[model samples]
Target: MAKETEIEEKNLLTRNEFDMLADTYQIKPPQFFWQANTYFDTPALEIKEQGAALRVRTKSNNYELTLKQPASAGLLETNQTLTEVEAKRLMEQAELPEGEVKESLHPFIGDTSMLQKLGTLETYRAQTSHETGILFLDHSVYLDTEDFELEIEGSSEEEVRKWLTSILTDHDIPARPTPNKIKRFFTRKQELAR
Candidate 1:
């Protein structure tokens, strides 16, 4: 398992804006890939209520489980690489993985066996390097809803924020309040359930 703090900024974009930016930056084929993220939480949504999120992502033939919690810089992320067997067990059975990820989660979810699959979000992502940071272009779909977004992750939060602002201003794209994918998914799930 690996642990680190994530520092990133995000902005919602229209499909037209996404395409225009891609063309302008010459972001082509090889830079894009698809990923599927499956989220999990307790029946009472204890994880989210505690301001934490758990997810297992699949890309190509690889799977990884991640736990994200509020942190000083951005979010503290604990990741664990998983085998197909392990991933299937967690996704299908709500079985928590062993090791650091489990240890880190115990404080919040005493008995992880209570965790259950919440929902899934799939995204086609394209990435490029910029002076301010690594820019990620994502087109995501979840619960029959779709969205386009841009994210910049860098060492300096101030620089990334400034750079993102400049880009939005230059392109005439209004920065809307874009909730993170997990939040959006959870909200949609609640909506559909009702």
Candidate 2:
């Protein structure tokens, strides 16, 4: 884990310093976005209720890949358009491959009908594209309110791996390409087993 002080120092970099570092590192400026999701989140009664989603995000003329899933009810309250009551009702009726029921903290029950506006979610995307001999790779980065995503695509898996490794070194960001489980459907069975 980065030490608190280290994070603070990184966050404190002046805009000019950040821009300079980004330029030197071939990193692009951070981009921000607000996405409105309209999905029926699963109820918490099942242990394996967390599901998966696919996102194709773009900014500054660059495109990237994203994978996401529903988290806690609190997370839904902040991201979705449904009121607590509406969400609870939808969750309770949500059909899962493995059937289950929805659940929430006690406080959510009494405040079902009321709606509260959540803040606009912010995200960033970074990318690099290059070719090696006859093969080409397009790499992209994604960040939601909570996590970061890196995706690699090329003529072959090996080329994708090489492309990813090169980006890691250039940006000084430490990460490895997870086993490619990319899928088109956004469902509990299709997503990673998180």
Candidate 3:
């Protein structure tokens, strides 16, 4: 299940900061699109406990099953294409369609059947490439939470991070502590349940 592993760095921003970056870079509206990500885990959140995540993301009628695990370089991602039916079973019944993604999850969460759909997060994302890395500005909504984030993924984490820092600093924007989208969604879900 070793595949598509890479480092992704994220920074949270205020509404003003997001708009400022957009204006500063002259980012066009044509680069924006929407995506919905549905996350899954055991009733006790075994995946997160193991420092891993599982999700089925749907974009333009295509469904993909992805498993993310913590790795030395960054996060190791194993991805597999899922048919509409397979995606349905995975989301509705906590079933894996039998493939690399399933095999990858077995080591982390022994019983895949325990998985349950956490919730779906919808994001309107704008992206463009720079000399250092790919830049993403995301506005996401899930449950009762809405947030904006800046993410950069490039050939190397250090280079991309330094580049991101310089831009934020030049604009006098304080980088806020940021959590991955899954964490934010799970946090809000837990809060509302309590």
Best by lDDT: 1
Candidate 3 backbone overlaps, count? 0
Model with the higher TM-score, candidate 2 or 3: 3
Sort the predicted structures by lDDT, highest score first: 1, 3, 2
lDDT of 1 by residue, 1-194 (tens): 89998888899999999998998789986888999999999999999999999999999989999999999888999999999999999989989878788999988888888999988899999998899589999999999799999898988789889989988999999988888999989988888899
Per-residue alpha-carbon lDDT of candidate 3 for residues 1-194, written as tens digits (9 for 90 to 100): 34876777788888888888887777767767888999999899999988889998888899999999998887899999999999998888878899999988888878887888888999889988888678889989898788988888887778877888987889897877888999888888888989
At residue 15, candidate 1 shows an lDDT of: 95
lDDT of 2 by residue, 1-194 (tens): 01010000011223353344446546644432333222322233121233333222233333222223344321122122233444434334432111111123222223322222211223343435446422111221222213334454454445656765665567566564332222211223234335
| Maximum-TM-score candidate | 1
User: Where is the poorest 10-residue window by lDDT in model 2?
Assistant: 1-10
Model 2 segments more than 4 A misplaced: 1-21, 24-40, 44-51, 54-121, 126-128, 132-150, 170-172, 176-194
lDDT of 3 at 178: 83
Local distance difference test values of all predictions, in order: 0.91, 0.32, 0.86
Kindly give the number of clashing pairs for every candidate: 0, 2, 0
- Deviation in Å, model 3, residue 91 alpha carbon: 1.9
Residue 45 accuracy (lDDT) in model 3 = 93
